[model samples]
Target: MPLRGILDRWNNQSLARQFLIAGGLVSLAAMMLVGAYVTTLIEAAVTRNSAASTALYVDSIIAPLLPDMKTSQRLDDVTTRALDETFGQGALGGKVVSFRLWRKDGTVLYATPDKSMVGKRLDPGEDLLTAFSGQMVAQFGSAEPRDASERSRDDPLLEIYNPILQPWSGEVVAVSEFYEVADEFQQSLHQAQLRSWLAVFGVTLAFFLLLSAIVFRGSRIIDHQQQALTQRVTELSELLSQNKALHARAQRASLRATALNESYLRRLGADLHDGPAQLVAYAALRVDSQLLTDPRTPHQAREKEVSTIKARLDEAMDEIRSICSGLVLPQIETAELPDVLKRAVDAHRQRTGLKVALSMTNGSKSLPPSAKICIYRFVQEALNNGFRHGGGVDQSVRQTFDNGNVVIEVADRGPGFDPASVGPDGLGLAGLRERIESLGGTFNIFTSKSGTTVRMSLNVQEMEQA
Candidate 1:
């Protein structure tokens, strides 16, 4: 039952409660076991000493006097005297002796402090039966019932019992007992148990307090790290939002540039078709008519003049054709940049009678009409420059598409010119560069001892949807 209760308490308690309860229980059990062991040891030691002292008193005085005695009463008197001398006065509650004399037939012959117990039949079931059998008995403290007078007192009594022997025959004759109280010892043990319980409780509380402090510190560090992580996430979110806005703005700018280029090319095509082409046609007609009918005295000078006029007219036709070709713009959503580049190369070749090679890498994909027209004009300008200033008449123009970019390059095996010497005002290459860059594209020119190459990259996807 006690074990079951301890198990229940252990299971029901919280961690701290369990610790405290277990500590207290262990301290209590250990103290109680120690106290019980100490009491038993003291009792054993006291019993052994008392038995030895009683035997010595009996052997030296009572046992020697029994040889001279003639009757049981006389032997009783000698045993009483011996007990009084050994235990001293008032030691056995003013009795001076404590002894019970019995015969071999289990009859009581004498008892100290009273004569009424003499000649009494000894009931083996009554007090001192084991003593009559010649065995020693020992007890500590008093067991008497207290009356009102004795109940108010603080002191208690102690007791001891031993068997007496006969002289010469060495037979047991009577029993003897003594007692003394020990109230102070019980009080001291109770105080020590209380002190032990208090020390256990104090130590348990201190240990719990230390553990709580450590847990609090660790929790604080975790909270700080979580807070820092949250702040960093907030900062990154804001940065991403700003970056998206910048990208949107850049896309809008590219669309605007594309629109402007397309409009410019459309207007340029209109001007050339309506004005320069008509004028060039009229001049050709006049030259043909004059060559057929007009006659002069030399005819040689007239023929030369007519020939010069015809040549000028043809040059004007070529210029107007070149201008119109440069103005060729396709639909932004439908035209492929490579196809547009091919058309521009063909137009320039037809107009100038110059051998031009076109090569396309990757596949053709649609781009904004403005982007196509810009590339067309750039090629026109490059071809024109090569025709007028480049030493080589034949040139290779290569176009490449990769990922989402379209690269258009025009190179000639010409006497390469120094880009630094040709300032912005000297060659229209600077204007071409400006036009390409305005559309969110790049323009680059490389001139070496062998040749000159102009390259530009247009974002095909951006241009097609602009």
Candidate 2:
């Protein structure tokens, strides 16, 4: 479980980091293995070459001085002096630590620097037995040394077994073992091993660096592509949300348009019934009056009644004209936003004799025909309501731009009415809400004892597109 957890953490790291960790471990192992192998080979080759040269020089000096072990396992006094002079005064003088001649039965036949060791019998070790079998065995103290050999000193020592050959028969005779001081050989071997390790390390480091560079470059590319993909997804999500909102607005507008025709006809019928229809009916009743039908009625009285009927008919005609005037819209489709607002305010002031302050700033001049119509009606109706309910004190109409949308606000400093108390009738507030929302706009009303504010926000960009 711990190993699984460790692997999970490792996998979570970036590609560059992962490659650096794994490659570093592998490179370390490879450097150590290869370096150790190369160093071993160099040490072995240096030891063998140095020991062989030293053994040949010693054999030339000491070989002929030895008595043939085939005849006797002892050395003559003359032969002992010859060996001692050779080691003491010759080329192997300081370097030769000790020397010995061994018979086949592990008897020390001759010895130098310690003549008491002569005639002492010792056990024949593996190296001595091999030397008697006609092969030289050489070892260096710095690398591997035998425990009981005379060459096992604190300083580096090279020990060798050089076998003596009989003159006549080529039979195994005896073994000569000697130890040499080997400071130069040890220094050369160390230098060779150091160079081999450095070469291996250099090669391994270069290879790891090249791999790391490539991995890091590819990781950067992958990270960049992932960021770009994430950004693209965010953009697409915003576009989808906008499309859904647009589709919802379209559906509302379609339903509102379908109901508008029926509403208009019903309002027209109600107006005619309340104003012209009543007056026309009253005039017809006056026409069938008993005074006009009776022949005995006086001419003067009849003339007075006839004049009264004419006045009533004229009043009825005026009522019909007023209704027609309220139903028809003025020409405002091609007018700019400022002109549209001015017309509405002026028409209300002319009709009701009320002062309305109109202010516009940062308002879009270009708009759709439907937006212009809606704006005009909104201003006209809002002003009428303010005058009726709030006494129209400080009446003001404002048109402004906010974040690409046009805001229209009608405010008055009067005792405001409760919004909850407003009833659904006469298409006053309800029609205003429908008109604004059909275009995907928003309407809000804020009321208090100090003042009332009715605001509508329309998207100028959407209207321009329409």
lDDT by candidate, in order shown: 0.63, 0.84
lDDT by residue for model 1 (200-296), tens: 5565557656755565566567668878999989999998997787578567556655665665666677777676766677666766665546664
Candidate 1: stretches off by over 4 Å: 1-322, 328-333, 425-427, 461-466
The superposed Cα distance between candidate 2 and the true structure at residue 274, in angstroms, equals 4.4
- How does model 1 fare in lDDT? 0.63
lDDT of 2 by residue, 1-466 (tens): 9999998999999888988998899999999999999998887788878878888888888877776679875888899888888888887888977788889898988776777778988888888999999988888863333334543467777888888878798787888888788888889988998999999999999998998889889989988888898998998899899889878877876676556657777888988887778878887888889888898999998898788888878887998887777777789999988999999999888988889998999535678989999999899889988988888899999999889888999999999879889764446777788788887789999999999999999998977777
- Top model number, lDDT: 2
TM-scores of the candidates are 0.39, 0.69
Give the range where candidate 2 is weakest over 10 consecutive residues by summed lDDT. Answer: 142-151
Off by over 4 Å in 2: 1-23, 52-83, 98-138, 142-152, 160-177, 209-265, 272-334, 362-374, 387-394, 402-405, 423-426, 437-441, 459-466
